[model samples]
Target: MNNNLHIITADTVREILDQYPLELYEIIKNSYILHDQQGSINAPSSFLFFPHRPESRIIALPAAIKPNQEKFNEISGIKWIASYPNNKLKHMPRASAIIILNHPDTGFPMVCMEGSLISATRTALSGIVGAEYLYNKDKSCKSLGLVGNGFIAKHIVKYLFLLGWKIENIHLYDKFSSSVEDFRQYIQSFGDLKITIHDSVSTLIESCSLIAFTTTEKIPYLNDHNLFKHKPCILHISLRDISPDIILDSINVVDDSEHILAANTSVHLAYERNKKDASFITATIGQVVQQKQTIPKNKTIVYSPMGLGILDLSVSQFVYDKVKKQDLKNIENFFPS
Candidate 1:
């Protein structure tokens, strides 16, 4: 194993991604394909919870994406990520993470990268990718409804631009009006979309052809069955906002059914409510991508990826390659060999 250890900062990671955004999306999509081909090892995430603050958690997600026909190099890593909602009260970012990529052959740590941005970027791209595949119709959306206007929503909107998604209108809703205005201003910089801030979540849901839930809800609150009457493709990114009845009534596709159906997610709750029956979940996003599963007619389709770690490792590998090409410094002998 190479003894050289490299440390990449968040600014560098973000800068590299901003320059080559399409590459990030392609790698993530390819990672999904890798997992689908049975060429990946995705272990269930281990959550570290605090007794004093139940809302906060640190998750260790470890995965490996093996070499595939997509020319994706083998990558293995773990993302040590923490989400502390209380951090917001202290004016800190609610989530912070670090990804460690190990050498595929030797299993030695090769790179340690700031992972919050990587996490957010992969999440944004993966959701859109699955949204496109699960969507039976055209790729271009008329209007996208954002249920929560936060950091992930910001990343989603940015990637939409990067990938040239021709969304003519954007309807947004947030529990807090301050965040609504803040996100409105942030999106207005894009110039060209009709921005509508809805006082009601249902109005936003009813208004758009595409909808994304990016909230931090720990429980199922939105039980309205009428929200999907328009048959919009829902990007259930936050995972727990929709109710069991809604989930059962919808056409759901997930990155991995087993991983997502655990952890008491809305789908998990649905499984529990229905005596652990998971037939309601139609297919994995890979099945949708490979056209193995037919996306049917006139039902609300939901794409919820359980945040795969292989994608993190893939993106980190991308960043590592770019950093090397640019001749960034790696601290030799940092491992005390």
Candidate 2:
């Protein structure tokens, strides 16, 4: 284990984004490994045991490789992150977290850093990658239907702007009224964009060419009757926020089929429990980006990413490397040695 540890914070992440190219190559690659790798673990609600409830969730995600790969075992302590949604506090973020990068063999602590930014950026990068493959830029993409208004949602919208997507029309819907309003004010500084708060899920999703579902709901969001009939819509299922019937109808593109099915979110698990086949899935997102297959024309495509550790590790690594280079002479010392 490396003892020369480095920590990064939300401010550091914003600084990194200003110069990090926001490139999707490494993000997309690590996302595939995280989705395909079997040993990765995720328990989203482990923090229910905590006394103070701030809309928090805990995740202990780890990944290891068997000896067969190189006649030796290797594991990584990529992250043990806690996401607490309390950004409303003055000078505080919606999600606050720390990640410990440890030695695979000795189990020694290596680096601990602010993970809220890492988590948020990696999540948004997944959506950006999905958009790159799922949506047709030539067809005049307009208006984005964002389902959840959390930290991750904000990054998704930010990346949409980065891709030259016009946000003249943004429809926001969340379970909490204040949360929706919070997002509206939070994003107003990005650009001149029209924002509307939708009272119903149907109202938010309708008539939008590009849609993103990033909620924490266990079940699908849209009902059977309200399914999108409009072909060629890009559906970025950041979380399991689509109905089983919708999953059944659309050309499903997963980051990894095995990982997504294993996570057992919504219809992905339902289809498995009943022994139903998933032959309709067009292709994995990696395959599409790698040119293994092309997204179908005039079809409602869905890209569901089962947030993976490799993605977390990759982003964390980026933050770590960048922070190490700083002289520590210019910024506040938020992360202690």
* Most lDDT-accurate candidate: 1
TM-score of each: 0.95, 0.78
Q: Whole-model lDDT for model 1 versus the true structure? A: 0.87
Clashes of 2: 2
Per-prediction tally of clashes: 0, 2
- Model 2 stretches with alpha carbons more than 4 Å out: 1-4, 24-26, 29-56, 64-75, 83-94, 103-107, 137-140, 232-238, 273-276, 327-337
RMSD of each: 1.6, 5.3
What shift in Å separates residue 312 of candidate 1 from its native position after superposition? 0.6
lDDT for residue 149 in candidate 2, whole number 0-100: 86
Q: What C-alpha lDDT, on a 0 to 100 scale, does residue 184 get in candidate 2?
A: 93
Residue 190 in candidate 2, Cα distance off native in Å: 2.2
Worst 10 residues of 1 by lDDT: 130-139
